[model samples]
Target chain A: MAFVEARDLTKHFVIRRGWFARPTVVRALTGVNLEIERRETLGVVGESGCGKSTLGRCLIRLIEPTSGQVLFDGEDVLALHGEELRSLRRRMQIVFQNPFSSLNPRMTVRDIVAEPLKAHTNMRGSELTARVIELLRQVGLNESHLYRYPREFSGGQAQRIAVARALALNPDFIVLDEPTSALDVSVQATVVNLLEELQAELGLTYLFISHDLSVVQHISNRIAVMYLGEIVEMGNAEEIFHSPMHPYTQALLSATPMVDPETRRERIILEGSVPNPANPPSGCHFHTRCPAAMAFCADEKPPLREINGRLVACHLHE
Target chain B: MTEPLLRIEDLYVRFRTDEGTIRAVNGVNLEIMPGEMFGLVGESGCGKSVTGLSILKLVPHPGRITRGKIWFRGENLLEKPESAMREIRGRHIAMIFQDPMSSLNPVFTVGHQITRVIRRHHHVSRREAWERAAGTLDDLGIPDPERVMRSYPYELSGGMQQRVMIAIALSCGAELLIADEPTTALDVTIQAQILELLNALRIRRGVSILMITHDLGVVAETCDRVAVLYAGRVVESGPTDAVLQAPAHPYTQGLLNALPRPSARRKSLQAIPGSVPGGIEEIPGCPFHPRCALADDLCRSKTPIMTPVDSSGAHLAACHLIGKSEG
Candidate 1:
């Protein structure tokens, strides 16, 4: 069994339009099935509104999935409750997307990192302070930052603080949701390296969710491509990035601008924006914008089938 | 070589904060040739955007272009009066910001906003302005420009909104377009489309572009010439291909090597050792020495001036170790 596995996970956000209006369902995740090995990073890549974030939340049980099974070490995450649930949360934590909003502006850095330790453990006073300071140093911050608020720190430093807070409990698994996307390139480089170091030292597993393919490629062992809440392709990071099977993945990789200026890549610019999740296409969700979509693609939803040691959902493959 | 279209000489911008004076742009120098796309790229607080803003005298108050010579079209713009600056701003030079939604007016119709920009610069009637605005939209590859013109900013998608912003920027028949991270908020596909549009505009209309971005990939793909900024100074300036192929400055090399390349797999990124120093505190040596691995005693004492790295003399890098490292 994988260290973490999600089976047919789906999340539908139903918003009520006025008191009398019928509720509309925004299908954020339509049946995501993926797995992460022990001590490995799984990258989920997709454009906006693709439910990659929802999948990240589901794996760590940050939010309840509409219908799915998230197995952590072959144990069902959805079944735990009370003390067991509280304890289980310590093993899995999440880092959010935006640094400015994730950390509380009112609280000092010490209090913020110590919050998780206080809630989950009996550590108090000097002991808690020592642990918080240690955590801060682990993330490349020092003693001076302990009394400072989130606003006082730069974007990269704030994100490091957030990472420190996530690592306070020494969680085995963490869902990093666009942790470095909000930062600049050079600072992002620092954060990326920090994550790698922490992962190595702590033997941590990560569900690294990001829209930036390049950043994801650097950290991920295996990569999964999502489109409109469905897992379009999943394979080795190098394989998926170098030669993607799914058309959506291909388009994404093509659009990813490489730093080398000499080679002018032949990019297939997709025609339109992502389809409205609430009113998705009839069959295959990607058929609306897929280039190699067959005539029957509009009517038949493709199943994720195994091919060449990788799983891909497309009509051409199966 | 052809005469440069826009030349920014020894620009310096500073902010008066309560803590102290923040040196934003410190002795920066760059030249943009006519009909060429030049990229000014760096991380936050690196003064890439401030340099772009200084070109248009758009640096916000509290933040002032303290010293600079902005030469555009064979004239020094720094010496020009505010009235002359205003006359040059929208008519000859226009700008597009990062976010499309915030940049575009929310209450106004897209057509009305675009036509207003046209009317602001050109002596055209409302009908003529509207026609020209729609025509500009059409040129931007928007289908049914009339229908789009009638819609409000909120009605359009983000990609469409960006196209509208581009429409307005180019509406006044501007020759130079200053795009400050124009596609940062956009999706990759939308960004590719917008980049293509910008490239198309450049090819067709011969518009000079001053594109500022943090992503080196964007610069690699679109820019003809590139300037690498660090700590409010130009560390390197060269042809895009030459600079990207072999970045001389340790900072530029670190940035390129650290940037996650899709083609390469790495055990760990070569992160720069230290963070950018807070504000320009009059560092005696190279501003990047604290973070640079190859900094020597000379590099720590005296600032390195831009020296030609190639026979062309166009590829320049400000690094004392460039010779030592290359050896």
Candidate 2:
């Protein structure tokens, strides 16, 4: 079994209009199937409102899924109740996207980092202080930052504090939701390096979620491209980024400006904004904006299938 | 060479905070020829935005230019009175902010917002301003300009709002546009459209653009020349192609390597190790020495001045490790 498995996971939010009227459903995750191997980073790349964040929330049971299975160690996450789910949560943690907003402004850095340990363990006094300090140092901050509040630190420092807090439980798997996007580019490198080092030393697994392709490409071992609650493509990062099969994937790659000027890439500008996720198209979710979209794309949904050793969901490839 | 449209020399901008003075833009120098795109690339707090803001005298209170001369069209802009700057701001220079939602006035209709700029600059009547605003909106590829004009900013999408922002900026036929991470909050497709629109406008109107961004890729695609800033200093400056092809400064080199290229695969990106120092009194030697791989004793003790690299005479970088002129 994979380290993490989410099969046909679905989450829907209902928009209530009136007491007697029927509520409208927003299908955040229609049917997401994914597997992350042990000690590997799985990147979930998508634009806004694509349910990748919802999927991240569902995996850790932070937000309850409407249907399907989220298997960690062959046990259904949704089914785990009471103390069972609490213990299961120790192995899975989440690092949110906005570091400034995620950290508690009222609490000191030491208190914030030790909150997880205090809740999960009986460690107290100097032992707790030492552990919190160690966690802070692990993420590249010093002991001097222990008493500082979230507002005292910069964006990069706040993120380090969040990372320290997330690592306090010694979790095996972490859901990193755009962890570095809120930071500056120079500081982003520092965080990226810290994550890589920690992953190597601790043998950690991560489901990295982001919209920035560069950061996603740098950290992820394998990548899954999502659009409107559907996985358009998933493969090894090298395969998906370089030889992207799906048109959506191609357009995304071409749209990004490269750092190198030697790369004379003709940009593949998509026609319009992402369609409203609440009222998604009938067939392929990406057909409306896809450059090579076929007539059948509007009528039939493409199935995720293997082609050239990569998972792709496009009629042109299949 | 043709006379440059805008030239800045020894630009020293400072902001007074609770923690003493912050050196925002220190001795910065740049020139943009007419119809050319210039990029000021740097991480946050590197004064890229401040440099852009200084061009239009839009730097907020307590953040004042201590020393510098901003020459636009053979006239020193810093010497101009508030009245003169008012005429120069919308008539000659306009700016597009990072967030479209906050930048656009909430109460006004999109049409009225754009017409306000057109009327202010061109002295057109209200009806004429509205017509011109509608035409400019249509020019910006906004569908149903008439309908969009009546809609509030809250009613429009982020992309549509950004397009509206661009139309307002371009409504007055401004000669220069300072885009400060205009598409940072947007998605890749929307960002691409905005870039393409700006590129098209430059060609059609012969407007010089000063694009400020942290993304090196954005600099490469749209900018003719790029100035890489570090600790309020221009650590590297050159043609975009030259700078990207062979980055001389250790910071610039690290930034390029840190990026994940579509064609390259690595087990781990070689990340630059240390965070940028915040609000230091003064930087000794090189500001990047603490994070630089090639830093030596000399780099830690003395700052290096920008010198031309032999590959191209225009390519300049401030680095002790790299020689003054290397073939």
Candidate 3:
């Protein structure tokens, strides 16, 4: 069995315009299915409103999924309750996209990192302080920064503090939702390197969710392409980058501006933006803007099936 | 050779905060030829945006262009009066920002905004202005330009809104377009569309574009020539192919090495040590010396001037260790 698995995960948000208006369902996650092996990074790549964030939240129960089964180490995560859920929370942590906003502005670095430890463990006073310092040190920060507030730090330093806090509980799995997106390229490299080092040392698994294809390809062992809340393609990172089966994935990879000027790919620009998730298309949600979309694409919802050693959800592959 | 379209010499911008005077753009120089896509690339607080804003004299309050010679078509913009500058804006030069939604007025319809700028710049009938507005939107590849003109900004998607912004910028038949992170908020596919649209506009209208962005990939793909901005300074300037392929400055090289490339999977990225210095905390000599791998005593004491990297003299970098070899 995979170390972590999500089956038929779905989420729908009901938003009302006004008091007299009827609530509309925004289908954030239609049905996402994937797996992550032990100490491996599963990259979830998609554009805005594709429900990548929602999927990350659902796996950790941060947002309640309408229907799904999340398995952690052969156990049903959705079935946990009370202290069981609390202990599971300790093992699973999350880092948000924006570090400055994620870290409490008023709280000092020590307290922010220690808050998780305090809630999950009974260690107090000097023992907690020592642990917090050790956590900061592990993230390349020193004890001198213990008393500094989040506002006193740069975006890179603030992100480090967030990582220190996430590591406070020694989580076995972390949902990194665009952790490096808000950072500069140079600083993003530091954080990415730190995450790789910590993963090697601690044997931690990462759900590295980002829109940056290059960064995703660099860090992830497996890559899953999402479009309109559906997993369109899943395979080894290298295979997905080199030979994308789905049309959306192909367009996304082509549209990505490569750093090397000599190897510019022929861009396949999609006609329109992502459709409104609240009222998605009839069948394949991506059919409206897909370059190779056919008539049946609007009537048939493709199923995720294994093809050529990878999973693809498209009639073209069939 | 023909004269340069826009030339900035010894430009300096400063913002006076309570902490100290933040030198935003310090001793920056640039030259944009006609019908060229010039990229000003940098990280946050590197003054790329400020430099663009300074070109149009649009620096927000508390920030002042303390010293600069903005020469546009052999005329110094600084010597122009406020009225002359206003006349030049929109009629000769136009700018678009990163967020089209915020840049656009929410209450007014798109047609109202575009026609207003049209009438402001040229002597035209209201009917003609509206017709031109629809024509510009049509030229930008917006489907059903009539409906888009009648709709408010909120009714449009991000990509559509950005296209509308471009229409407004180009409606006046401006010669130079200063786009500040125009496609940063867009998705990759949408960004590609916008970039293609910009390139098409350059070719169709023969308008010079000054693209300000932090993404080197964007610069590599679209820009003909590029300039690298550090903390308030231009550290490198060269043809895009030369600078990207064989960067002379350590800061430029560091930034390129720091990016996560697909070919270097699982390998450790060469992250530059330390973060960018804050605005108030000024560093002497080379601003990047603190983070540079090749910093030495000479680099710590004296700022290097821009030196030619090759025989053509088109490629340039400001670094003390440019020609030195490590012992």
Among these predictions, the greatest lDDT belongs to 3
lDDT of 3 by residue, A31-88 (tens): 7889999999999999999999999999999989999899988879999899999998
Candidate 2 regions exceeding 4 Å error are A17-22, A261-264, B262-266, B289-303, B320-327
Calculate DockQ per candidate and list them: 0.71, 0.60, 0.86
lDDT of 1 by residue, B279-298 (tens): 74878889998887777899
Best by DockQ: 3
- Which one wins by DockQ: 1 or 2? 1
Angstrom error at residue B103, model 2: 0.5
What is the C-alpha local distance difference test score of each model?
0.90, 0.88, 0.93
Residues A193-252 of candidate 2: C-alpha lDDT, one tens digit per residue: 788889999889999999988778878889999988889899999778767899988888
> Could you tell which candidate, 2 or 3, scores higher by TM-score?
3
Model 1 stretches astray by more than 4 angstroms = A261-264, B262-264, B324-327
lDDT of 1 by residue, A32-83 (tens): 8888998999999999999999899988888899998999988899998999
Error of 1 at A103 (Å): 1.2
* Ranking 2 against 3 by DockQ, winner: 3
